[model samples]
Target: MSKMSASNLKLLQPSPPQDGLACRATDGALSIKTVGKIYDPEGVHVEALRDCSLEIAAGEFVAIVGPSGCGKSTLLNIIAGFDNLTSGEILLDGCPLATTNTSPSPGPERVVVFQQGALFPWKTVIENVTYGPVVQGVMSRAEAIQRAREMLSRVGLKDIESSYPGQLSSGMQRRVEIIRALINNPKVLLLDEPFRAMDTVTKSASHQYLLELYSATGKTIFFITHDLEEAIFLADKVMVMTTRPGYIKKTLAVKLPRPRQYAMLAAPEFIAMKADLVGAVHEEAVKAFEAGEREMA
Candidate 1:
């Protein structure tokens, strides 16, 4: 069977329902309604996003994947309420995401886990993980420390809680950062290539750990990665963006069964979906390259 046909067959199969509280009427679920963005009106005036619309149901795992510079990061920032949209709107649950051009809000319910594990170098693992709760008055120092310890144990970093970030390996630091994000009990977890730096074996282990964490927490996740295989493995739906002036070129629903294992990669269905996404990405890349040439001429 052709790849697309195989993918369709997989889609027809029923998957287990996700568990979560009903989203508030004010927030509907996370969505980008005809979003667009332009950076620096003079210097290349890059249209980072164009007429992109997406809706991610509560507790869903959606991955945004494309070539580098496809504006995936910008979209994630907008969803996190970090960047303002030039046009259109981003709605969470059902409410519009509000932010100022000069000062962005560090929303209490939304958390972003950046690449390279953005932890404080001076603080110990426990201190860094508890900082959010401390700053937000979510708990007393003693309570926060206790919460931090619990989270550290959950992520398998309990013994390293007293160690500073500089004292840990990159993988260990990522564990701490993930625990920090988890400790917030965030409504949405925005991850941008969070495991891109790890070795394959380490990445695989972390991937399994993440799946287990998500299974237990049931938080909505918006993951961004350039790795097609990673996107295939992790997301329920994978959104492919154009190379530049990024738009949703295509959105592929992953019908693969879960909890998915590495062996799923060998399935005919998995191979087909990957091929379709790869083709879509290549077409967008070619179009973007041609457009760049025209502008330069």
Candidate 2:
């Protein structure tokens, strides 16, 4: 079989992300109220999220948990300025979020580490980590290099600065992505299942590391995940979402003592809390499934 010519293949390729880098700015608290999203013009409008209202404090770690297709990712995207709300509003501190087509000024305070790591394969680890600071014009070449190295060390990847993404494991790749996100000292870290591909052991370790990062930097985190245990372990406040056309089913404050350990997972209090969350989420999941069935019918 003959390969397509470069000229012919160019047109078939997808356009790359505009390669904009977010800078660090004072990230105000995130507030969403009665926010709804509907994605249909002529068909039955499918609501990905409905009337979801929540407030994440400037330095709190909040975990969003729900079943598949529950709009967890959708909600995160809305806050990230990647999606639009059909009704209601999202505010940062008190200012409405910037969602116009123009790339907002790079605010080093809010950074998102997508689930896929989304690293550039051609770039070495140092380059990948340095991309954010470099693009934001925050540091000189030498300064950015030093900052990148420091971030890599913080993530336990100091010796692997020259490694390529393809050479690292899924967990390692995630660390690189995280370090890149944090190099700018973002105030609010939006993580969309950053550990979905890791092994259980790796996940646990990464979880602890993340908590340490949270405590050390006081960086507010809005994390989305389907794993109940993971949410239970990490969040200071766990927000449960209903299934499709998701809504906030419940928001439970995890009063579990911090500096947590594995023993907490096996305790009755922990188990009870987990059960309560599961029950709350289960109600929404079932309702969502039935709604889908009715729509199909």
Predictions in order: lDDT: 0.78, 0.77
TM-scores across all candidates?
A: 0.86, 0.85
lDDT of 1 by residue, 1-297 (tens): 011232332322212222544434233268788888889856867889888888888888999988777899998888777777788877677776742343446575778888878999999888898898788886788987887776566556778888999999877787778778867667788999999989988888778777766666667889999888999999899999888788887899999887888899999999999999999888877787787789899
The sequence of per-residue lDDT tens digits that candidate 2 reaches over residues 45-67 is 78897788899887788999987
Instruction: Report how far off residue 124 is in candidate 2 (Å).
Output: 0.9
Candidate 2: what lDDT? 0.77
Q: What is the lDDT of candidate 1?
A: 0.78
On TM-score, the leading prediction is: 1
